[model samples]
Target: MKEDELHAFLTLQRIPNLGDTSIKRLIARFETAQQVLDQKKESLLKLDGIGAFKLKAFFEKEHRLAAEEELKFIQEHNIDYCSYKDQNYPERLKHCIDGPILLFKRGSKDFSQQRMISIVGTRKVTNHGVDFIKQFVEDLAPLNPLVVSGFAYGVDITAHRAALDQGLDTIAVLAHGLNQIYPKVHAKYVKPVEAQGAFITDFWSSDAFDRTNFLRRNRIIAGMSEATVVIESAEKGGSLVTADIANSYNRDVFAVPGRPGDAQSLGCNNLIKTQKAQLITSAADLIYLLNWQIEEELKPVQKQLFVELNAEEKVICNFLSDVGKEQLDLIALHCKMPTFKVASILLNMELKGVVRPLPGKQFELT
Candidate 1:
């Protein structure tokens, strides 16, 4: 967007009562941020969802001054940004009713990747949670999906590192401005994350860092992805909030189940029980449920020679090798395994390039 238009958008953001959704309504009617700002109070109040109270600060001069200051900081830092209407704005986020009207970013400035997933959990993550994240990202490495997470402690940082270790792109959604990093200790990972992907936010450098900002931050993490995975979360935590937000967005949510007595497991279990999220034990379940297809060229040429299969996988492989092709239910019935278990195993086998899914849920050895 041009400088003047960006300034107009920033000014709109600075208004106290006007939010993204309300501002969007104004933009739709006026066609541009500048145009909206130029309209008289009587004109703006006539629009649906607009009220006299919202327009009380609409013509304030302080907002325009704040926008100028923020614009200067943006230019000095060489920050990259995109308006909601820009072509490069995150495609999925664009559909969110309350998604930020403007997003400031650093690093690659690319939102082109179609296969993005956000992994989130409590800041106080368990060892088991860390292991799950590492394995999950590694197993998903072949598909080369972009990983998105808040750059905080525990699950978020672990997910980001796992993606980086696997040479996958990762985006860190921040609660604060790009001027500084939260927790300060995580400053070390800044450059590495920027090199691999980006750090994006709607908050400006002048904004104060507050706990309340995290709720807003979580929305970006949920809004930018096709799915959100809760590796571990307490009964009440920000990760669960992200899961709720993801569900509200009508996006798929996956939660890893934990032991019955574990405190961290309660949130995930509740989410699953409430039908707010689908239960996922492994990356295979996500890939299967999402119906993400492996590229033909990316498939391994020799499955048995290099890939290792467990007892159940070997049984499925042998059965498919002999039968040529079979449906999921028939394979499960003949193999004496539960249909859900067989489904997960088949998905794992598909990832290993040992088999390929066919029409009507049939599977054939590759």
Candidate 2:
């Protein structure tokens, strides 16, 4: 965003009682934060959800000054930001009504992709949880998934490291400002995180770190991803909060079930019992459930030559015929089929000798 526009957004963020939803509403009415800020109090108060109390800080010089200060901090730190309207802003988050108006992103990473999954759980992660995360992330590496987490201790950092070990990008959704890393011990992982992924937050350098910040941060972690997975959690934890937020956003949620007697398992168990999240034991289950698997075996052309395909298979066969040989992932992506379902159909087609798998995981008509 341009400096003047960035300044305007920062100023809007500084406005009290004006939340992301309200700011978005104001934007819809006025087009830009600068436009909204420039309007007179009488004009602003006329809009729905706008009130005198919310606009009490309107026309205040302090807000402008604060925005300028934040902007300077951003520039000095070489920080980057994306407004909600920007093309680079997360697509999933864009659909969230309460997503941050201005999101600050650091490092070489991309959140716009559809493969990101938020993995959150308790700070007191168990041996089973650690093992599960490592094996699961390693297995999920084939999908090139972007792991999202809070970058805290236990499950958060585990997910980050697990993804990193698999050479997959992982994002840290921080509860505090980028100016400082919380739980200072996790500071060691910062450079590595920046190398492979990034740290993102909507908080300003001047914002104080607080417990409630985790709740706010949870929204970003939950909102940006295709799914949220709880590896392990106690009865009450931030991971559950993220799960609830993800469900509210209508995103898929998964929980790793634990033995009934385990303290750390209570939250995930409850989520399954309450039907809030699907149960997933391993990476394959997750891949199948999330439709990330690709079609492997397809029938040769001989089978389709003799037996006509249904409408769906016709779409897939026609697409493959046009594209020549195609990767299953690309086929699924282009044909708009869930990877698992398409894979199964391709397997059936393979048995029929209508399509054949080639070297390097490509599929072509036989």
Candidate 3:
């Protein structure tokens, strides 16, 4: 975003009652942040959800002054930022109505990776949780997914380290501003993290550090990724909040099932029991559930005249041949079979070199 537009966005953020969603609503109607600020009070109040009270501080000069100070800080620190309207903003986050309007970043890595997943859990992660994370990242290394976490102790730090050790890009979402790192002890990981991926936040350099900030930070963790994984959690924690936010965004959420009696497993167990998250035991389960194993280069294969086929496989092959390419659900619907059954048959066909998987859960004859 240009300086003037960024300044306008900062000014909008400074307004006491106006939030990201409200700002977005205004921007959608006005076409730009500066345009929203230029409108008269009568015009602004005509929009739904914009009331007289919310606009009481909208025209205040103090907000502009505060924005100027923030702009100066941003320039001095060489901080990078992206507005929600920018093409570089996170693609998944743009679908979230409550996503931040502006995000300050400290690394060169962009959010263009095809696969990103947020791994979050309790700060009091157990030995088992640590082992699970390391193995999970190792297994997922081939796919080269971007790993995202809050950069706190226990589960967060472990996830970040696992991704780093595997030479995978990892994003550390902060609860505070980029001007300083919280937990002072984590200062060492800052450079390595910035080198690999980025440290991103919506908080200004001057924003106060508070417990509530972590809750706000959780949304970014959930919003930017295709899925959220709960490595371990107690009955209550920030990880659960992230899972709920992911669910609200209609993203897939996975929970590591633990022994029922373990304290850290309570939250994950409840999520599975309540059907808020899918149960995941390993990286293979996640890959299969998300259909992340589709090959990019599908080699051409001549039809095998002598290849034997079962009834279901023949049905799927015929359907794909007729439609050219079809998704798993559509194939299931037209083939008169359950979706899960069709998925199994497709896998068998893929192994038999009769078909190949495509992106977006699609399939076609080889």
Clashing pairs in 1: none
Better of 2 and 3 by TM-score: 3
Clash count of each predicted structure: 0, 9, 0
Q: Per-residue CA lDDT of candidate 2, range 16-108, in tens?
A: 888999889988999988898889888987888877788788778899999999999999999989999999999999999999999998899
What lDDT does each candidate get? 0.92, 0.87, 0.91
- Model 1: how far residue 156 lies from native, Å: 0.5
- After superposition on all C-alphas, the RMSD of every candidate to the true structure, in Å, is 1.9, 8.6, 6.3
Who wins the TM-score comparison? Answer: 1
How many angstroms is residue 265 displaced in model 2 relative to the true structure, after the best TM-score fit? 0.2
CA deviation > 4 Å runs, candidate 3? 294-366
Best-to-worst TM-score order: 1, 3, 2
Candidate 1 on 1-366: residue-level lDDT in tens? 999999999999999988999899889888999999999988887887777777778888999999999999999999999999999999999999999999999987399999999999989999999999999999888788999999999999999999999999999999999999987999999999999999999999999999999999999999999999999999999999999999999999999999989999999999999999999998877876887766666545446677999999999989998999998889999999987788878877876678988877788998
TM-score between model 3 and native:
0.82
Candidate 1 Cα outliers beyond 4 Å, as residue runs? 298-310, 347-353
Q: What is the lDDT of residue 222 in candidate 1?
A: 97
Clashing pairs in 2: 298-350, 299-349, 299-350, 299-354, 299-355, 300-353, 300-354, 300-355, 301-354
- Candidate 1: residue 163 lDDT (0-100): 96
State the TM-score for model 2. 0.82
